[model samples]
Target chain A: EAGVVQSPRYKIIEKKQPVAFWCNPISGHNTLYWYLQNLGQGPELLIRYENEEAVDDSQLPKDRFSAERLKGVDSTLKIQPAELGDSAVYLCASSLGLSSDYQETQYFGPGTRLLVL
Target chain B: AQSVTQLDSQVPVFEEAPVELRCNYSSSVSVYLFWYVQYPNQGLQLLLKYLSGSTLVESINGFEAEFNKSQTSFHLRKPSVHISDTAEYFCAVSARGGDDKIIFGKGTRLHILP
Candidate 1:
């Protein structure tokens, strides 16, 4: 089966510029997540979507970062007026199970590496 | 809150050498631990996980990890590694009864030299 898909494998932009990253989860997956991975570090969860609803977003920078998963299939993570610190790999992942009782495995996409100068 | 830590940032091992990557977690409640591997220019893939069954778990490609509850550790191990095993491995944990938020540790890069 085809895995989760992400666009723009790499992106470069100057500081204060807005950027958007797109992600399409696996066909049958129900839970979608967005994570940020800085160089030499593991991914940190930015937001999580249970279908069309964003169930968790406490880690998201509300001032500049925003995300949306419409129709519960695809998602878009946006960073407005991004700073140099925003330069990182944006990874998108999806899981098939939504229930907490069953911890399902998450499949990831080829992340979009963003560089802000 | 839960957190994960990978003690080593990088480990260099020769081909056909047995290797182990150490991982430790801290949580107030029960948690599910995972090991994800990322190859060069690729996305992270799940290598193995510990949920609720046996303390030992093995991946299809020969990697194995034992979940030690008392030590609060889940270390990845392989009997013998090949060059193809070179990759960055991440250790992660999420509280079993909490909000399902996963915390990842800084990755450990495995370098296999022939």
Candidate 2:
């Protein structure tokens, strides 16, 4: 089976500009996650969705970051009026919903590398 | 809440030599441990996982990790490594009864020398 897929492998934008990243999870997977990874640091969870319902988003910066999974298959993460600090890699992962497995393995995508100047 | 710590930020080893990457975790409840590998410019892939089994787990590429409950450590070891083994490894943990959130370490970058 194909792994998770992400679009626009890279993006470079000026500060205060809007940027968006897209992701498509593996087939039959019901859980999707968006993570931010800065240089020399591990990826941090920004939001998690279970079949179109956001189950966890405490770590997301609501003032500038927003995410949505309309069909429960593909997701979009957007940053409006992004700041210079927003430059980093945006990773997407998927797994079987928690209701299906006690601990499911997450499959990751190639990630979208964003640069804000 | 759970947290993971990777003691080494980078490790350089000669080809065909053994290597060990250390990982420590803290969690109040029973947890699941995972080791993920990310090659240069690639996505993260599951190297191995420890859920409720024997303390030892091995990956297909000759890498193994032993879960030590008392020490709270899950160090990954490989008796022999190749050039392809060069990558960054991350240790992560998720509490069993928690909100299914996974906490990851800073990651260890392994460099294979000739």
Candidate 3:
């Protein structure tokens, strides 16, 4: 089976500009996650969706960042008025939804590298 | 809340030599541990995971990690490494309950020397 797929492998923008990243999770996966990874740092969770419902988004910066998974299969993460500090990698991952008996592993995408000047 | 710490930011090892990357986690409850590897320009791949088992897990590429609950450590070790092993490795953990949010450590970059 194919792994998670992300679009626009790389993007470059100036401060205050808007940028968006897209992701397509593996087949049959019901959970999707968006993470931000800065240089020399690990990826941090921004938001998580179970099917079409966002189950966790406490870490997301609502002022500038927003995400949606309309069909429960594809997701989009957007950052409006991007700041210089927003330059980093945006990674997407997916896994089977919550289950008490089984915990499926999450698979990741190549990630979109964003550079904001 | 849980957190992970990777002591080494980088590890340089000669080809065919053994290597060990240390990982420590802090959690109040039982959790799941994972080691993911990211090659250049590639996505993160699951190297191994420790849920509830014999405390030892091995990957297909000769890498192994032993979960030590007392020490709160899950260090990855490989008897011998190849050029293909050069990549970034991340250690992460998620609590057994809740939303299963995973916390990751600053990845360790493995460099294979000639």
Candidate 4:
């Protein structure tokens, strides 16, 4: 009955430091996504996981950003050597995996607010 | 690749007044359209979505949007606005096939006045 859950509601870090955000999706959801939302802008897809497999990550900045969903239930998004521009809210969402019978309606978590100085 | 455009950056209206938020998309393939609302410090919530069947979709909160293939637009409207409805509304589009990665617009901030 609980919705998606995320950890560390807020975080502040200096430039060049490392930061991480965690997320726990709704029960029975097989698809997980990580999105970055900057101020005055809509959320942008960073990565998506179908079960434990990352299907899309082109939008992710490989040099500094990385994500993983080991058990296919909870996910973690990390940014190493964070920059000022990396300050934003990181949102996690999940949905029923796409299949013949499933319709993907992603439910989002509260999100982690990150501030990089 | 798909992209969404929210024509208005912000919409201000009085309570009980009707309002419309415009959204347009560009895609080469078939796609699914969605509208999401985000309250201050909250996550995005689905308002409505258009998958196939009907070109018109309505949300439980009295919000409705019609998908116009000719105009390539999906404009959200509400017959009556409430102060609680004040929030940031996002327009998103996703490919019907492929990875289903959603492309979101800049967002339209709706400010309902009392």
Best by TM-score: 1
Q: Worst ten-residue run, lDDT, model 2 chain B?
A: B95-104
What is the per-residue lDDT of model 1 for residues B8-106, given as tens digits with 9 covering 90 to 100? 999999999999999999988999999999999889999999989899999999999999999999999999999999999999999886786999999
TM-score, structure 4 vs. true:
0.96
Question: Which 10 consecutive residues of model 4 chain B have the lowest summed lDDT?
Answer: B94-103
The CAPRI category of model 1 is medium
Ranking by lDDT: 2, 1, 3, 4
User: How large a fraction of the reference contact set does each model reproduce?
Assistant: 0.63, 0.50, 0.56, 0.52
| Clashing pairs for predicted structure model 3, backbone only | none
Candidate 4 CA-lDDT value: 0.90
Can you tell me the CAPRI class of model 4? medium
DockQ of 1: 0.66
Model 1 chain A worst lDDT window (10 residues): A96-105
lDDT of 2 by residue, A1-117 (tens): 889999999999999999999999999999999999999999899999999999899999999999999988999999999999999999999998855332678899999999999
The runs of at least 3 residues in candidate 4 whose Cα sits more than 4 Å from the true structure, single-residue gaps closed, are: A100-103
lDDT of 4 by residue, A2-76 (tens): 999999999999999999899999999898889999988899989988899888899999999999899888999
lDDT of 3 by residue, A67-97 (tens): 9999888999999989999999999999887
Q: What tens-digit string does per-residue lDDT give for candidate 3 at B1-114?
A: 889999999999999999999999999989889999999978998899998878999999999999999999999999999999999999999887556578889999999999
What is residue A59's positional error in candidate 4, in angstroms? Answer: 0.9
DockQ of all models, two decimals each:
0.66, 0.60, 0.58, 0.55
* DockQ, model 4, C-alpha based: 0.55
List TM-scores for all candidates, in order: 0.97, 0.97, 0.96, 0.96
> In candidate 2, how many clashes are counted?
0
Which prediction has the highest DockQ against the true structure?
1
Question: Cα RMSD for candidate 4?
Answer: 1.6
